[model samples]
Structures are given as C-alpha cells and as structure tokens.
Target: MQAVITFRQFSFRYKNQSEPTLKNIHLEIARGEKIWIAGPSGSGKSTLAHCINGLIPFSYGGEMSGQLLLDGQDASGMTIFERSRRIGTILQNPDAQFVGQTVGEDVAFQLENEAAPYDVMKTAVSSALELVGMQAYEAQGPHELSGGQKQQVALAGVLSTQADILLFDEPLANLDPASGAKAMRLIDEIHRNQGKTVILIEHRVEDVLLEHIDRVVVMNEGEIAAIGTPDELLAAGILPRYGLRQPLYLEALSHAGLPLSGFTDLSHPESLKPTEDGSEPQGPPILSESQLRDRLEAWSTSVLPAGRGSLGEPLLELRGVSFAYEPGMNAVADVTLTVRSGETVALLGSNGAGKSTLSGLITGLHKPGSGEICLRGEVINGWSIRRRGEEIGYVMQHPHHMLTQHMVRDEIRIGLVARGVPEPEREQRTEEALQICGLYPYRNWPVSALSFGQKKRLSIAAILALQPKLMILDEPTAGQDYRHYTEFMEFINRLSGEGMAFLFITHDMHLALEYADRAAVMSEGRVIAEDAVARILADGGITSRANLRETSLARFARAQGLVSPSRFVEAFIAAEKKVKRA
Candidate 1:
C-alpha cells in the first residue's frame, strides 16, 4: 500500500502559544484505506487533519517542525489551492463551509474556482449530489436545508472536486441517524468503489463506520496514544480510559454480565446473541411502565396546567406565526405552540421544516409578522431584545456564535456580573459551573485553544451561570459522541429536576425519544402535532409530516423481533455486568 499521508516527527505551535498543539507526532495513512481517528477532545485529532490538508502551517500562523508529505509531495511547500486540488476537506460546521445560496451552486463553487469547463463542472456537480444522496435538493437554498442536509451539501462540494483523499472533521455532527447512515454509506462506497483514501475525525465510535473501518488511530494530548484494529484496542481497554465508547454491542455484552469466552470478536454485531439457548435472562426490565410513568409525572408536575377550569398560562406562546426572510416566501407559517415552567419539550422535524425559524421567533431574534407572542400570560410584543435575554437563555446550534470571551472563566463570569449577582456569589457560582462542565482545569486557558467539544461544554456553563428560568438549547448534543452525550444529558436532567424549563430544538430523534417528556412535531412552519415521545414517533401522520425516520435501535429491534427497544439497552447493560464478573 502506498502512503498517502505521512507525518514524520511533526510538531506545531500556534502563534503566541507556549506549548505545541501537536508534538512530535509520527503517522502514516495508506492510499485507499478508511481510517477512524478517535480520542478525547483536545487530543490533536482536528490538528492532525488540518496538517494533512495544508491548513495548519499556511492558513494558521504556527511554528512548525519536522516533515509532512501528502501524496509524495512536501506539504510545507504546497499552496492551499494546490493542496485542495488533491485533498477534499469537509469541516465540522457545514454551514460555515458553504459558499453559495443554492445547493447546486455550492457544489460547483470549488470546480469553478479551478476554472473547470462549464460542462465538466455541471457533470461533476450532478454526480457529487447523487453521490451524497442530495440530488433532489440541488435547487434549494443552503439556508433552506436542515443541519444534516447542509452537511451533505458541503460533502457534495468536496466530492465534486474529485479529490483522491477525503478528510472529514466530525462529518456526522448535527445529522440525524438516517442521514448519518447515508453519509457513512457514501464514505464506504467511496472507499470500496472509488478506492479513495479517507480520514474521519469524529467522536462517535459506535455503529457509524465500524464495519467499514480498516484501522483505528487514537490520539491523546497532541500525541498518538495507540493504533491498531478495533479488537486489539478494545481488548486492551484503551477506549474507555480516554472517555471514548467501544462498540455498543461490545459494551452491551459487558454490561449484561455475559461471558466473553463465547464471543471471539467483540466488534462483530453477531457477538451480542445469547451464547446458550437456555441461559437465564437479565434480572428485570430497566424501565417498567410504572417507573416511566412516575418519571413522566414528576417532569410534568412543575409545568402542568395552572388550573383545571382555566386555560394554563402560557409562559411563551405563539399564535398564527409565519416568517420568511423575503416577501412571498415562507419558511414557517401558522405555527402555534407554548412553553410553560418546568417543561422540557423537544422540537422535532426533518431538514428544511422550519424548526429553527420557530426558535428564532420564540427567542425574539426574528419577529413573526402575522402572529402574537405572549410571555408570562401577557403579550410581550413590545419587549426589546435585551429584555428577552433576561427571561430566556438561548444557546445556538453553534457554540462559537455565542462565545465572546478569551477565557472560559471570564465567559461564565460575564453573565453573572451582567445579571447583578454579587461578586462573591458570582465567583462561587462560576466555580461551580466550571466544575459541572468539567472545565475547571482549563479555566484560565484561552477560549480559542479549546476543542470543539470543550467549547460546547463551556457554552453550557456560560448559560448555567445566568440561571435563567427557561433555557432554549438548539442541537445540544450535535457533535458529541456517546460518552459526552450521556454525560451532558445527565447534567441537563439534573438541572431539569431543579425546576429549570428547557425548550430543546434538535434533529436527533433518538435523543428526543430517550429524554423528552413531550415531543412536538414541526412541519412547514407549523406545530402539526404534539404528544408523548412514543406516541408522536408512532403516529404515522406526524412522522410522515415531519420527515422523521425510525431510530436505528428501533429498526434493529424490528429486524430482530425484539418486544421492546428499551430492553436492548437493559440487556446490553446486563451483559456488561456478566462479562465484568467473568
């Protein structure tokens, strides 16, 4: 196999940075191989990707050392345009990467830059859209697409260039499972059919590229930690130590107290089956109806209707809300919804369905010309932007948009100071927030130095410092992997228990199914239906209207004829316990 990307004792230090982000790293990626880079956040995974694509030393001013070769050429001497012609890079934020209004134009933007012929560019754009399964959306505006669709458009743009090596930085971030599966399939197809070299920088280790990955490369604190086959790495227990999840099937088996002797390969999906036909089942269901009901009741207790006789007071309400940036166009229309105290409601919808527009209206960032907004049982149509922030803390889909401070500690403290909190209490609260967000160690670190995941956590901490009654979080777990996702949600659950109401705007159906007390489906700028999570998901009308797909677990359960999907989580946990005992 020919080496496509090679880093020999490479080290890099950003401008004014005392320490190197990447230190004496040595790595080699062979041509036509699909590799997964997995590790804790701030582990130089993204830096490694940037180094390969000529962004590190060229675009980013940094002190560089050692040698880096891309396709047998020294990366140190290559211009960005020259490097880009050989490598296709899809960044973490697809929206930031998009350069054109329409999908077709965006895909063709790269080719046009290279001065490709009109016919050639057109054919490349068409083929790229087809490759990403977004051929039907070519005419749609980039802003009109959902988070997942935006990512796919960005991917199509990269593919249109026909670069031999594809570099993806958290490509699955903000995508729903179905779209994620599609993207993964496309990557696999590129590797198998096109024989392209691929490097995937991601945190999610379960199920995305497990079957297609040829090898695993783990990085920690700017250095390579370990590199090997998934089996070799998991058997050595290296993944969990760095907060990365092993394959769910493997983790589930371990949690279920199952013996590993019967399973030769933990990575194999078939390894999860019962080893013996007559083996005893796990102790009991993890979530009984009574338990689930109790949890639901507890959640609803704080926000239940104010009185049986009178319509409940709407903390925030929208009626006949319709909005679009231009005249004669509508992104959201006739949308009516309400959020009350102590309620955690999930906004569910497919790409381009206007959920984000609804969020902007509720937050007062965008006004609904056709409808009224009532806050605290009174119409707040006249409230200023500053006044809305006092009552509601809105966290955008991208944390960078909200972050304004140079240090994490300062970022958290700014909100407290603005809210008139006493200096002593503010300090105490800031410390507590940092501790909860697991950023205490990095309190004094520059905000720009933080990794994507850490920046997300810091954003949450900043919001927590304000202690707003209602928090609106958009795609809260967008780029997070299983471990971080679980940890972050656990924190949210704790806050919800403390009487904080949340309006969670998300595209992840699985997260909504697992965490939301009530699910509201949005379509064509309207709240088409609202019900319990299970009911909303099962309602064919709502599901179809929202363009929602069945969860991966649900699909797997149906394929295996399992009675309940929740049982799988419990069974897997039980298997893990059994394995630990053995």
Candidate 2:
C-alpha cells in the first residue's frame, strides 16, 4: 500500500478570505484504495478535493502553504493539466458536464482535445462506455437518458481520460435510491476491476456504505477529524455529533437503549448478534438479549396507528392528466392526484418517471395534452404560468435558477412588486417571508455570499412572499447537510401546520418519511400508488418497480423477524416525532 496522495501540514486560503479553507491538514491516501471524505456542508471537504484536483491554486487562485505530493512528486510544480492527467473529477450534476449531444461524442471530447487520431478517439470512447456498461447508449442523446444513465455517461467521459484516481463530489445528491445504489456498484466495479483509487465526497453516507470502503475520513472545519474503517467510525459515534446522519438502523439501536459498544462491527444491521455466552452486553449494564427483545416489542406495540386529522378542502387536483414532450411518448399519462389544504405530499419516482412533468402541468409551465387540472375545485387548465404563480409557487431544484435580484431582500420583494400588491402589504409580507425562512439576518447580504442551503431558503422566501396556497418544491434539500436539512424541513412542516400545502418532488426518502404525510409513487408516466409514507416505502413490490429502496429501519425489522415491519416502521416514526417534541 503505497501513498498516492500525501498532504503534510497543508493549508489553503482563498483570496479575500480571512482564514484558510483547509487548516494544517495531514493525510495520506494509498494507491488503489477507496475512501469516503464525509462532513457537513462547509466543513472543507470540497476544498480538500479541490486541492487534490489542482483547483485550489490553479483555477481558484488560492494562497497555499506546506506540501501536497501526488505520486511522490510535489503538486505545486505541476500544472493543472498535469494533475488532471492522473485525477479525473466527476461533478454532482451530470447534466452540467455534457458538451456533446450524443454520449459517444461526449466521451470522446477529452481525447479530441489531446489531438488524438479519429480511430484512437473512437476506441477510447467505446472502451470507456463498455467499462460503465453503457455502450448501447453511445448514440443516444444525453437528455434521452435516465438519471442513472446520465451518471454512467459522466463516468465514461472521465474514464476515457485514463485517469487513475476518480474523485466523485456528491455523486448521489440528485439520484433516486435505486439509481444511487447502482452508481455505487459501478464505482466499486471500477475500483475492483480497474484498480483505480476512488475518493468520494458526499452527504449520503448511508448510500455510499452499501459497498465496501477501505476507510472513512471525517473532516470538520478544514481539518481531518478521524480516519478509520467504517466499523471503527460508526462505533465512535461521531457522525451525528458533527451534523451527519448515522444509518437509520444504528440510530434505532441507540434509541432502543441497546449499547453499540458490545458489537465490534456495527456497519450493517445484519451484523448485530448476541454474545457467545448468555450474558449482558459489555461497556454498560444494559438489558440481556431476551430483555432487549421484550423492551423493543413493548415499545413498538404501544405506538398508536399513524394518521392525521380530517383533511381540509381540496386545494389542487388532476383528473386523468396526460402530456408529452414529443409525439407518441407521454411523459405523464392518465394520472390523477389531489392535494388538500395544509397537507404535505411527496411526488416520488425514478428519473424519467414523469414526476417533474406532472408538476409542469400543475404550474401551467406545460399544458396537459388531455384531462383537467383543478385548483380549489375549479378547472384551471387554461391559466397562464403567471396566473398560476398567484396561488401555486413553484421552486426549481436549483435555487440559483429562481434567484434574480442581487440581495436577499430584493429577491423576496421583486415578486411582490411585480404582482402590484400595495406598498404597505408588500412590505409586511416581505418581512414575514424573510422571518419565516430564517433569512432576515441575511436580507441585506449579496445572494452570492449565501451558502447553497441559504440560497434554497431564499428561493422559498421569494415564493412565500407571493402568499401561494400550494408550494411545489423540486429536490428541496439537494445539497443541504443533516442539520440544515432538519432546520429547513422542520420550517416547511411548521408552514404546513399553518395551512400551506406543499407538493415535494424529491428522491430523498428520509425527507418523505419525516415530513411528508403521504407519498404518490409514479412509474412509466403513471400513478402506480398513493398512500401513507410508511406504507408506500414498506411495499417492496412498489418500491422495486418505482426504483426506490426500503428504509434501513424496515430492513432491520425484517431481519429481526418482527411481526409487522411496516407497523414497526410506523412506530419508529411516531417515536421520533415524540422525541423531537420532548
């Protein structure tokens, strides 16, 4: 195990920054090793990756100190191209990296830039696509692919460069559960068969742990906090302390008064076992195995059925709606749904499953080819996008897309000013929106200075100023950390409690489980099922068909031979809510 990357007391400060983004970092990554660099947002994980990929002092023009060695050579002397020749970076958004219309052409772009011959470029493109198992999609347009296919194409483009080290930044941020698991498998295959070093910086720790990782490097405030095997880190109980989430099953074990210290391997729920001799657990005077089971059963069976009160009047409804971007292919077809006042509903499916298309029809961005869209029991199919904005505020997945004004205050006020609300009322609503979104302190700050999470809230504040009855949010918590996610989503819950209905188009199962009252699952342009969040997630048939994965808690229940895994899941959710309240 030779060190391919070494950082010896390395630190970097961006221009105009008072402190270094990375502070006295010392780390070593062995060649061909797969490691996860995980932390909450702004913990300096991305900055470390930038340094490795030669973006810090190259593209970003940062002040550097100490040494960064790549393959036993000084990185400071090497140009960006020199470093890029050994490290290929894959961004979070695959759509942002596409330069060619077709997958084959895109993968060949790097070879062409090197002035390689046509035959060489073609062979390289084929080899790369074949490695990612996407050769059949070589001639297809990038937009014609699903989210998983697009990610594969992105990986293929990187592989064509023949870089030995693959750096993935938030690779699973925008993908559904099934696609994300597949992505992890592909990365693992590349690591095993290709013997390439894989460095993944992501917020989705649970998803990345699906494959075997050589080590976990936890970063906090631009410093390496800890580095160890997954079992070691999970046993340390530091992930949640630093605003990152532990796997749901691990959290459940702790909540149930089961000591994790007794188990040497805590990475997977299936690994939990009783002691060889009939004895209580170590490191704490906890319950015996049988007592633990009895305690769990008592707590679980005592939970009341999970449901909400009577629903308010219907706010929005789609009756047999259908739409298509091209002829003879419906993006959304024969779908029907309803959102009542004050309810939070999640629109869920794999990419290309028609979730976003249905939202477009509801918001008047695209008219339905057939059927009716009713708002408050009245058909509003012919309404303009502007008119629909009056009652339905749509938040795009990327917050930057919705931001226009330079300052947060102006961004929230611009929409109100355009709608001709009275000056006094507009002022009041703008302040209310800012306060509601927790953006009042940053109201005068430049939009560019806000973090990704803050920008998301600002976008919501802008839409909130319109006083819309129904808010449609697409991937609302894409890049947010666990802390920011809880804060942001809990705020949304408060609003929902105050009678504002929300339609969440998301791939985040955790968000749906904790915040959403119900989930409407879509598959192949059709509404396959709509029911309680726990039930929808508990159904393996529906989850498999819709490209969703069962929650870890559910899997843990099944592994433990619980009577009703779905009910067990519901009971856990109920207990979590009660804990939050306390």
Candidate 3:
C-alpha cells in the first residue's frame, strides 16, 4: 500500500512550553486505510491530527523538527489552505468552524473555498447533506440546530470538500446513540465507496469499531503505545491502562461472569456470538429472572454506599415554563421540574428535544413567557444571567467558550475577581478549585497550552470558584480521559453529599446510569418521564421515544428471556462500581 501520511521522528513543543506535546513520533498511514486513534485527553492525539492538517506550526506557533509527508509532499511547508484542500478536518466543536448562517451555505462554503462553479457547488452540497441525512435542514441556521445536528452539518461540509483524506476529531461526542450509529454508517460508506483514507480521533472505541477499521493506534502521553487490529487489541485488554473506554459488550459479559472465549467480535453486539469450533453456546445464555436479580442485587449491594439516602430540601424549582426564540415555535414548552440539594439528576433527551433550551431557561439566557423560576424558594425571573450565577452556575458543553484568560490560575480566579473579592479570598478560592479539579500543577501554565481535557477542567474550576448552591453541568465529561472523568464525577458526588445540587445534561447513557440519582427525560420540549436511572434504562417505551438508550448490559439482559432490564442494569452498575469505573 502507498503511504498517504508519513511521520518521521516528528516532535512539536508549543512556545513557552517545557516539553513537547508530540515527541519523537514515527508513523505511517497508507492510502484507503481507515484507522481509529485512541488515547487519553493530552496524549498527543489532537496534536498529531493538527500536524496532518497543517495547523501545528502554521496556526499554532511551535518548535518543530523531523518530517511529516502527505501524498508524497512535505506537510510542514504547505499553506494551511493548500493542506486543507487535501485533508478535510471536522473538529470537536462544530460550531467554531461553521462560517455560514444556514446549513446549505455551510456545506457549500467548502466548495466555494475551492472556487468551484456555482452549479457544481450546489450539486456537491446537496449530495453531501443527503449523505449525512440533513438535506431537509438546508435553510436552518446553525445556531438554531441542536448540537448533534450541527455536527452532522460539519460532517457534510467536510464531505463537500471532496478531500480524499478525512480527519474526524471526537465525531460522536455530542450525538445520541442512533445518530452516532448513523454517522458510523455514513463514514463507513464514504470509506468504502469513495476509497478515502480516514483517521478518526475518538474516545468511543466500541462505537467506532462498528464499522470495519483497518487498525487501531493507541497513544500514551505523546507516544504510540500499541497498534493492532480491533480483535487483537480489544481481546488483549489494551484500553484499561490508558484511561480509555473498553467495549461495552465486553464489560457486560464480564459483569455476567460469562467467559469471553465464546465471542468472536466484542466490538459489534450483533457480531457477538459463540465460536464455530464447538467451544460454547452459539449465543447469549438465557438467564432466569430470579437468577439475574440475585446477581444484580449482590452487585449493587457491593458497589453502592448503604443507600442513596434521603435527598435534601428543594433548592431550585421551575413552574410551567415556556420559552421560544421565535413566537409560535416554542423550544421549551410548559416544563415544570425541580432539583433538590444533594442530588445529581441526569437530564436526557434527543438532540432537538429542548435540553439545551431548558438549560438556557434555567440560566436566564431566555426568559420564560409563562411560568416562574425560583432559586431557594425565591422567584428569580428578573435576575440577570450573572446575578443568577451567584446561586446557580452553568458549564457549557464546549469549554472553550467559557475560557477567556491566558493562564490557568487567572481563568479560575476571573469570577471571584469580577465580584470584587479581596485578593486573599480570590487566591484561596482559585487554589481550592484547581486542587479539586486536579489542575493545581498546571496553574502557572498558559491556558492555550492546555489540552482540550485540561481546558474543560479549567472551565469547571472557574465555575466552582463561585460556590453556587446548584450547578448545571452540560456534557461535562465529553472530552475527558477516563481518569479525569472518574475523578470529576467523584468530586461532584462529594459536593452533592455536601449539599450542592447538580443537573447533568448529557447523552452518555452509561454515565447517567452510573452517577445520576434520577433520570429526567425530555421529548419534544416536554418532561415526558423522570425516574431512577436504572428504571429509566429498563423502560424501553420511554428510551425509544425520547432517544435515550439502554446500556449494553441492560440490552443484554433483555436478550435473555427471563432476565429483566432493571436487574441487568443493577448488576452492570455494581460491576462498574467494584472496579471504580476502571
């Protein structure tokens, strides 16, 4: 196979940094090969991607050496625009890259950049949009679209460029289960039909492996740790040590105490069947309800602290709230909800189901047209977003939007400084927040030098400095490596115990099941259901309707005729807790 991307002793160190983000790398990616790159948050995955896209030394000033070749040409000397024409990149934050107001214009912008004819651009845009199932949203503004929808539009824009090499950064970070599966299919189709080379930087390993990938390249702290085929790497348990996700199916099987030797492919649930060499049953064993229940109950008892205990008094309340950007098109409609002190509630729904809009309403970005929002029993409709922040804080999905300062310590100290706090108090709060977020060591580092995950931590630290009674964390775990994800959740759990209320808005069903005290589901701008997370996962009717999904363990339990969904979920969660979520 001809090499499309070649790295020879490549290394990069950002200005003012002590060490290189990428160090002494040597890698080769052949044409028409699809590879999934797995790594911890700051393990040089994104830095490597930047190298291929001509952003490292070009846009981000850095000390660089060695050589990176793309299509037999050196990538170092090429202009960003020239490299962009050959390598299309869909970044983690789709909104940041969108240049056009509407979907059609966004998709066509790439073609326009290429100076293609109007007719040719139009045809390419339509085909690209249709490929991503966003053809009907041609006139919708990117801001009006949901996070998942915006990501899809971004994918369409990249496709329109007709670049044979595509680089996707955390493509499924914001998508629901169904949308993510569809995206996998779309990318697979492009790889197969167009014969393009694809390099995907993703944390959702299990999901990406649904399509056929030629190899997996695992990175650890600026170095390649391992590279192998899916079966070889997964079966060898390569993900646990690196702060990455393991295949959900394998986790499910382990929880059930079943031997994994029977399975052929752990990546795809549909492909998970017994071996043909007469080793075990041809499929999942049917577990009885009582048997499954016992297993789950034992697991739960082992993992959960004596109990969820009594929840604290109500800290925040919403009464019949309705809001709209444009009259007669209500984005959040008549939804009444509450959050009690010492509770972490997972707010879940589809991409366009009004979760973000509801967050906006709660944060006072959009005033309610009908009902009232109360903080600690006081109506707060007149409060400004900043005024509300004194008692209520919000951390957005993308942390970059919340980060403005140049240094880590300064970023955390901004809120306290703006409130005219004494320097002593401000410094105290900043140090406390950084310590809680495990960012104390990086306090002196420039904010721009932090990786995406580190930036997210910085964002959280900024919010924590306020000491709000309640915090709404919107997809706080998106870009986190496993270590940070677990530690952050533990921190939240500790805070919840100390009487801080939390509303967790996220698409990760596993996170919801593992951490949420309760699951509040929204559908078409209404609170359709709210229940314990385990019960919510068990309720197929609600999950399917609202686009919330059952965990693989729950689904596996359902596959067994006698086992119940809730029972399997209990056992799975217990297993996770026993392992402290690996």
Candidate 4:
C-alpha cells in the first residue's frame, strides 16, 4: 500500500521561539486507513496535523528540520493550494473556514478556486452534500445554521474537493451529543464507503472513530508517546500520565472496580458484551464532593439559576420581558422567570431561540425594551456594565471574542485589577483562578498559543477571578472535551457551594440531563416552559417546541427499550462497571 503520509525526525520551531512545537516525531499513515491522533491541550497534536497538511513550514513561518512526504512527494515544497488537492483539512473553528454565505456557495468556493468547470463543481458539491446528509441545507446561510449544521457543511465542502486524505481538527468540539454522534457516523460512513484516508484529531475517543480507526497515535508534550491499536494504548496506562482523561466506558468500569482483563481489548467486538454470569461485583462509590462540584460547575452558565431558594426573594427576575433587534423581530417575548439564590437553572433552546439574548439581559449586556429586570427585588434597568460585572460575570459564547489579553495570567489578572483589587492581592487571586482552571502550568503562555478548549477555560478563569454573586456562562462547554468538562463543572460546583448562583445556557441536552436541577425552555424569545430537568425532557413538549432532536444517549436508551429512568441509569452504571473490570 502507498504511504499516504510520512513524517521522519520532524521538528518545528515557531518564528523567534527557542523550543520546537513538534520535536523529533516519526509517523506513517497508510492509504485508505483511518487514524486518530489524541493528546491533552498544547501537546502538539494540532502542530502534527498541520505538518501532515503542509501548513507548518509552508503556510506557517517555522524552522522545520524534518522529512514530511505526502503521497510520496516532499510536502515542504508544496503550496497550500497544491496540498489542498491531496489533503482536505476541516478546521476546528467552522466559522473561520467558511467563505460563502450559503452552504452551496461555501462548498463550491474551493472547487471554484481550483478553477473547476461549473458543471463539475456543481455535480461534486451536490454529491458531497448528500454524502454528509446536508443536501437540504444547500441554500441556507451558513451563519444562520446551528453550530453542528455548520460543521457538517464544512465537512461537505472539504469532501467536494475529492481529496484522498481528510484531516479533522477537533471537529466534534462545541457540538451537542446528538450532533456529535451524527457527525461521527457520517465520517464513519464516508470512510467505509469510499475507502478514504482519514486523520482525526479529537479528545473524545470512546465513541468517536473508535470502531473505524485502524490505529491510535497518542502524542505528549511535542512528541509521540505511543502509537498502536486502541487496546494497546489503553492497556499501557499512558493516558493519565499525560493529563488526559481515559474513555468514559473505561472510567465507568474502573469506577465499578471491575477487572481490566475483560475489557482492555477494546478492538474485540465481544469485549463490549456483558459477563456470562449476568452479574458483576459491586465496587465502592466513586462520587466525590469535588467531582460532583466539578460536574455541576461545568454546566453552561445560562442554564443555572440566580440563587438558591425554596421560594425566597428573586435575585434576578424577569417580568413580562420581551424584545427584538427590529420592530417585527421578536428575539425574546413575554419571558417571565425568577432566579433565586443557590439554584442552578439551565436555559435550553434551539438556535435563534433567544437563549443568548436572555442571558445578555441578565448580565446587563443588553437592556430589555419592555418588562423589568429586578436585582434582589429592585429594578436595575440603567446599571452600567461595570456595576453588573460586580454582581454578575458573563462568559460569552465564543472564547476568542471574550479574550483581549495576550497571556493567560494577564487575562486572569485583568479582571482583578479592574475590580480594584490591590496589586499584591490581584496576583494572588489570579494565581488561584489559574490553578482552578488548570491553566496554572501554562500561566506565562501566550493566549494565541492556546487550543480552542483551553481558551474557553481561560475565559471562565478570568470571570471566576472576579468572584461575582451570579455567573452567566453562554455555551461554557461548547468546545470542551469530556475531561475538561468534568473539571470545569467541578470548579463551578465549588463556587455554587460558596453561595454563588449560576445561569447556564446551552444546546446540549445530555449536559442538561446530567447536571441541571431546573430547566427552562425557550422558543422565539418566549419562555414557553419551565420545570425539573427530568420532567421537561420526559414531556417531549420542550424538544418539539424548540425544534431540536432528542439527545443521543436518550435516543440510544429508548432504542434499547430502557424506558424507565431508573433502569436506564442502572444499565449505564452496569455497563460502566463492566468496562472497568476489563
């Protein structure tokens, strides 16, 4: 078989940097093979992906001392356009990759750039969209689509190029469980049907590309730590050593205290089955206060309530709130809600349902044109952004939009200083914030150098340093992996325990089911429904009202005939326990 990609003794140092981002790396990818490259943040996984696509020494200014061959040709001498014909790259940020207003235009942009004939481009674009299950969105504006839809469009655009090798950079990041599963399934189908060579860079490994991957390559600190089958890498126990989280199924098994012998060989289809005895020994409970806290904190800020109360005074209350950008535009309409002290409430809705706008009003980023916003039973209609920051910390949907500082440490300290914290005290608070966000190790690192997920954490860390009474996070886990999500939530739970309320906004139904206590569903800027998470999800009214699909886990549970909530939980726990024993 031809070697689709080959890297030998590859080392790359950025302009003016003393250390290389990728160091002494060696790798080989066979044609028609699907491989997953995984590691913790800042481990050079992205750099390696860039190397394979000829972006390192070609597009990016860097000192390259290595051999990179694409289709048996030296990659260093190829232009980006030349490389694109062989290796189509779907970037982590879908917005950054989009150049056309509509899905059809965007997918055809690349073909047109290559000067393909109109008929050829049209035919290729149609087929690519169909393959990715995005044919219905051909005329839809890319910006108007949901995050997941946009990602699918981006993938279709790449496929339209007819490249032999497809490179995915954290493609699942920011997607809800349902959308993530759909995207993964589409990729699997493409590889199986076309025998395409695929290179995936992602953190969620359990369900993504696991069954389809020919091999798994693990990177750590700018070098390859292990390269082998999924089973081989998992058994070696190198994941935790590199600050990466083990797969959830594996973790579940470990939590149940099951033996590793039964499930360590993940490649074997039989390994996923239950034991012959139909029962596994019970293990000690793995739940910890810290873990619980982390899980709760990780819930999107927009979902949380303003405070804890059985029926106490509302910290933030919206009475008959309604507004829109234009006269006929109704972003939010007749929204009436109250957030008490010490309660976590999640705002659940589809795209353009006014979740973000609702959050903006609560955070004082925008004022309601009608109705009243009350703080502790008092209206604060004209409060300044600074005053609102003192009471509520708002973390935006996009981390890049919120980031202004060049360094991670400085970003954290900026909030403290602005809050009138003394220089010495500000430094101490900044350090604490960094430690909480797991960015302490890279305190001095440039913000530009951080990954999409790390940048999200940094945005939260900066807001956390301010220590507001209510924190509103918009899509907090949008680009995060399972491990980071766990950690981030734990931190939030700790803060909630300290009497800080939160409002979480998100499109992730699984997240809402797992972490949220209270749920609020919105549609067309209206607070149509509100109830407990379980009740809201069970009703199916909210999903239909919001025009969203049921979460993947929920769908899978239903398919398996696990209707009862308790039964589903028991099965999940049992499956998790079974894996731990392997």
CA lDDT, every model vs. true structure:
0.75, 0.86, 0.83, 0.74
* Better candidate by lDDT, 3 or 4: 3
For model 1, what is the error of residue 196's alpha carbon versus the real structure, in angstroms, after optimal superposition? Answer: 0.9
Query: TM-scores of the models, in the given order?
Result: 0.81, 0.93, 0.91, 0.81
RMSD values, in order shown: 7.1, 2.8, 3.3, 7.3
Candidate 1's C-alpha runs over 4 A off are 100-105, 117-119, 133-141, 231-237, 247-251, 259-261, 264-340, 368-376, 379-382, 481-488, 526-545, 566-582
lDDT (C-alpha) at residue 554 in model 2:
80
lDDT of 2 by residue, 434-481 (tens): 886667877887887565667887887888788789999999887777
Model 1 worst lDDT window (10 residues): 302-311
Top TM-score model = 2
Against the correct fold, how does model 2 do in TM-score? Answer: 0.93
Q: Write the per-residue lDDT of candidate 1 for residues 317-418, one digit (tens) a residue.
A: 777788988887888888788876666789988666787788888778888878888878777767777888888888887899999999889999998888
* TM-score of model number 1: 0.81
lDDT of 3 at 192: 96
Winning model by lDDT: 2
TM-score of 4: 0.81
